[model samples]
Target chain A: MNDLMTRLELSALQDRYVSIIDNDRMEEWPTLFTEDCLYQIISKENEDLGLPAPIMHCDNARMLRDRVVALRNANIFEQPVYRHCLSGLEWTGDGADGYRCQTSYVVINTSAAGESTVFQAGRYLDHVVRTPDGLRFKSKRCVYDTSRVQTLLAYPI
Target chain B: MNDLMTRLELSALQDRYVSIIDNDRMEEWPTLFTEDCLYQIISKENEDLGLPAPIMHCDNARMLRDRVVALRNANIFEQPVYRHCLSGLEWTGDGADGYRCQTSYVVINTSAAGESTVFQAGRYLDHVVRTPDGLRFKSKRCVYDTSRVQTLLAYPI
Candidate 1:
C-alpha cells in the first residue's frame, strides 16, 4: 500500500479496535490481533523494570479466550458503558510486514447508574499488519497515564 | 539531559509517584505536579474525539487541592489498597521545556483482607518539566486498557 493508504488503513484498524471495546463485546475484541501476538495491559510502574507480567498478558489465543471467559463469568465490576472518541491518528512508520501508528485520545466510562467518569486517557501504540483477512493487530500495547486505577478493570479498552 | 538520562529521570518520577499512591498518601501525590499543571484521569475510549470529560480534571493547583479535599471528605469507594508496578519507561520526545515520557505497567488492588486482583493495567503519558523542586508534571494523562471500570472512581488513579 502507498503511504496514504497505509495510514488510512491503520487509522481504521485503530478505530475498529476501540469500537469493539466501546460496544462491550469482549469476546470479539481479541480477534483483532494475530494468533501468537503478545497482548499486554502495561503500566509505567511495571514497564520500567522490563517486566513481562501485564495485568492481563496473553501470549497466545487460548489465554485471550480465558480472559473473555473470566470477564463474562467471574469478574464483578459495575456494569460499564464506554464511548471512544479518538483523534490525532498519526502514522509513525512502515515496514515490510506492517505499519506503525501512534494516536492519542480520551476514553470515557459511564456506569449503569448514569454517572460518567474518565476511565483513562492515553494513546494507542499499535502495530498493524496486512493479512488475508485484511488489517489486523500484530501487537497492541495500551499505555495508561494513571499509575493508580480507581478500581477493577473488567473489560478490554 | 541525554535521552538515556531523561528516561532514567522519568522512570524515577514514575516510581516516586507510584510510591505515594501505594502508601495511601493521597495528599502528597498531586504535589508531584506544577502549580499550572493539567491532571486528567481519562480512558482510551474517549481520547480520540477530545471531548470526553476527565474523571478528574484539575487545571491548576487550586482544583487539584479540591480533589484532595474531596478524597478526604466527600468521596467513597472501597477502602482499597493499591500496589503499583511500573515498567518500560521510554523517553518519547524532548523539548526546551520538558520531555514526554511513556511507561507501562500494572496496578493491583488489594482489599484489607489480603484478597488481591488486578485493578488496572495501563500507561502513563506524562509531560515532565524541570521545576525548581525537580521534575514536575505539566500534564499527566492516565489511560487504562479497559474501559469497564468497577463501581466508582472516587479515588485518584
Candidate 2:
C-alpha cells in the first residue's frame, strides 16, 4: 500500500479498536491482537523501575481471553460508560510485519448516577498490521499518566 | 551518551518521577516539565473520538502547579499507600531535545487496613531531557488498560 493509504488504514484500525472497548465488547477485543502479543496496563510508579508485573499482563491471546473471563466473573466494580476521543495520530514508520502509530487520547467516564468524570487518562501505542480482512493489532500498550489510581481498573481502556 | 548510558539515565529519571509522586512531593513534580510542556492524563474511552479533554491537562508549568494545589486542598478520597513497580524499558529514539522511552508498570494500592490490591496497570510514554541539574520530564502520558476505574482519581498517576 501507498504511504497515504497505509496511514489511513492504520488510523481506521485504531478507531475500530477503540470502538470495541467503548462498546464493552470484551469478547472480541482479544481477537484484534496477534497471537504473541504483549498486552500491558502500567502505572507510572512501576514503569520507571523496569518491573514486569502488570495489573494485567498477557503474553498470548489465550491469556487475554482469560482476563476478559475474569473481569466478567471475578471482578466487581461500578460500571461506567466510556467515550474515547483520539487525536494526534502520527505514523512513526513501517516495521517488518506492521506499522507503528503513536496517538494521544482522552477517555471520559460517565456513571449511571449521572456523575461524569475523567476516570483514567493516557495514550495508545499501537503496533498494527494489514491483514487479509483488515488491519489488526500486533501489540497494544495502553500507557497511563496517573501514578496513583483511585481504585481497581475493571475494564480495558 | 551511548545507548546503555541513555537507558540507565532514562530509567533513573523515570524512577525519580515516581518517587516524587509516592512521596507526595507534588510541588516538585511540575518543575520536571519543560516550559512549553504538554501534560495529559487521558483514558482510552476518550481517545477514539479525538478529544482534548484530559482529567488534568496542563499546557504550561504553572498550570501543573495549580493542579497539584487543587488536588492537595480540594480533593477527598481514600488514603491509600501506593507502591510503584516499573520495568521493560524500551528506548524508541532520540528526539532533538530528549529521548523517547516507553516502559511498563503496575501499581499496588495498600489500604489503611493493610489490604493491598492492584490499583492500576499501564505504561508510561515519556519524553526525557537533560536539564542543568538532572534529567527531567518533557511530557509524560499514562494510559491504563482498564477504563472502569473504581472510585475517584484525585491525584496524579
Candidate 3:
C-alpha cells in the first residue's frame, strides 16, 4: 500500500482499538494484536529515564487474555465510561520490518454521576505488522504523562 | 472531489486549526473562518438540554480578531502551552449546504513549571464551506464534556 493508504489503515486500526476499549468490548481487545506481542503502559518520566518500570505489561496473547479476564471477573472498581480522543499519526519504517508509529491520545472518564474528567493523557508507540487477518499490533506501548492516576486504572487506557 | 479526498482535506484543515491555537498564532486564527462566522464554547450538559448558554461566543471576524487582541494584551492569566489532540472526523450533507462535521478533541495544558494536565475534552461541531482560499469554517461549536474548566480559559482550545 501507498503511504497515505497505510496511514489511513493504521489510523483506522487505532480508532477501532480505542472504540473496543471505550465501548467495553474488552474481550476482543487482544485479537488486534499478534500472538507474540508486547503490550505495556509506562509513565513518561520512567520511559524518558530508560527505566523498564511498567504499570501494565503483557508479553504474549495468553497474558493479554488473562488481563481481560481479570478486568471482567476479578477486578473491582467503579464502572466509568471512557471516551478516547486521538491524533498526530506519524509512522516511520515500512511494511518489511513492520511500521513504527506514534499517536497522541487522551482518554476521558465519565463517572456514574455523569461528571466527566480527563483520565489519562499520553502518546502511543506502536509496532504494527500485516497479518492474514489484517493490520495488527506487534507491540503497543502507552507512555502516559499523567504522573498520578486519578483512580485505580482497572481498564485499559 | 471524492469523499476520501474531501475527508483528507477536511482533516488537514482541522489539524491546521488546532496547530495554530497550540502554537499561539492567535492573529491568524480569524483568517480560517468566514467573514461572518459563529464560534462558541458550550458545556455538553447545556448543549444537550438545548440551552443557548455559552462560556465564550463570538460572531463575525471582528469579534474573533478582538478576542485575539484581548488575549494578547488584556487577558490576565498564566501562559500555559496547549497541545490539542483530535480524532473522529465525520461529516454529512454536501457541498451545496456546506459540510457539517463533528470531531472529538482533547487539549492538554503544560504549565510553566512543567506539569501536564488534560485542560479540556470535547467535540467540535462545525459547518465548513469552500472559499477561494480554501476550506473555512462558517460555524464552529465546541461542546466540552469537562463541564467545569480547571482554570480561567484565556485562550482558545
Candidate 4:
C-alpha cells in the first residue's frame, strides 16, 4: 500500500486496540498482535535514561492473553472506564518487517461512581506491520510520565 | 566549530546544567538559559497526545529565577540531591543561528539520610544558541514518562 493507505490502516488498528478496553471487549485485545509480541508500559524516563525495567510487561502474545484472563478471573479493583485519547502520529522509520510510529496519548478514567481523573498520559512508541490479520503490532510501548496512576490499570490502555 | 565540536559543547553544557542542580547551586540554574526562554516539564504523552498541560513550566528567565527562589525560600519538601544522567543526544537540525537536539535522561534523588531513588526519567528536547553569554538554551522541554512520581517535584528535573 502507499504511505497514506498504510497510515490509515495503522490508525484503524490503534482505534480498534483501545476500543476493546474502553468497551470491555478484553478477550479480543490480543488478536491485534503478532503471535510473538511485546506490550510494555514503561516510564519515558527509564527508556530515555536506558533503564531496564517496566511497570508492566507482556513479553509475548501468551502473556497478554494471561493478563486478560487474570483481569477477568483473578484481579479485583474498582469499576471504571478508560477513554484513551491519542494523537501526534509521526513516522519514525521502517522496522525489520514493518513500520514504526510514535504517538502521544492520554487515558482518562471516570469513576463517576467515584471521581473523574486523568489516569495516564504518555507516548506510544509502536511497531506495526501488514499481517495476514491486517496491521498488527509487533511491539507497543506505552511510555507514560504520570508519576502516579489514579487507580490500578486493570485493562490495557 | 564542526559538528563534533558543536556536539561536545552541547554535551558539556548539559553536564554543567545538571551539576549545578546536584551541587545545591540552584540559584545559578537560570544563567544557563537565554533572557527570554521556555523551560517546561511535560509528559511525552501530553505532547504526542496533543494535550496542552505542563507538569512544570518556567516560561521565561524570570520564572526560572522565581522557581529557584521559591525552591530556596518558600516551598517545603524533602531535602534531597538530584544526579541527572543524560544520553541519546541527536542533533535535529540547525535553527536560526543555533541548533536543536533530543536527549534522554534520568534524575536520581538522594535524601541526606537515605539511599538514592530514581526521581524521574524522560527526554530533553532542547534548542541551543551561541549567545553573547556562550552556549545557552533558548528552550528546554523536559518530557518524561513515569506513570507516577516518587514525590512532589519541587525543583526543576
DockQ of 3: 0.16
lDDT of 3 at B102: 76
Candidate 2, residue B95: how far the Cα is off, in Å: 4.9
The RMSD of every model to the true structure, in order and in angstroms, is 13.5, 13.9, 5.9, 12.8
Candidate 1 lDDT, A1-157, residue by residue in tens: 3665566556556655765665566788778888877777777566777776577567777777888898889867665665554667776655676777777755665555444456776666777787888888787776666677666866666
lDDT per residue as tens, model 3, A1-157: 4788778878868876885776567999999999999999999999999999999888998899998998888767776667788878899987998899999987887665545677889999999999999889999999999999788877777
List, in the given order, the native-contact fraction of each candidate: 0.00, 0.00, 0.18, 0.00
Worst lDDT 10-window in candidate 3 chain A: A109-118
lDDT tens readout by residue for model 2, B100-127? 7666555667788997765665556778
Q: What is the TM-score of chain A alone in each candidate?
A: 0.87, 0.87, 0.97, 0.92
Report the error of model 4 at residue B118, Å.
Answer: 1.4
Which residue runs does candidate 1 get wrong by more than 4 Å? A1-157
Candidate 4's C-alpha runs over 4 A off are A1-157
Q: Comparing candidate 1 with candidate 4, which one achieves the higher lDDT? A: 4
lDDT of 3: 0.85
The prediction achieving the highest lDDT against the true structure is 3
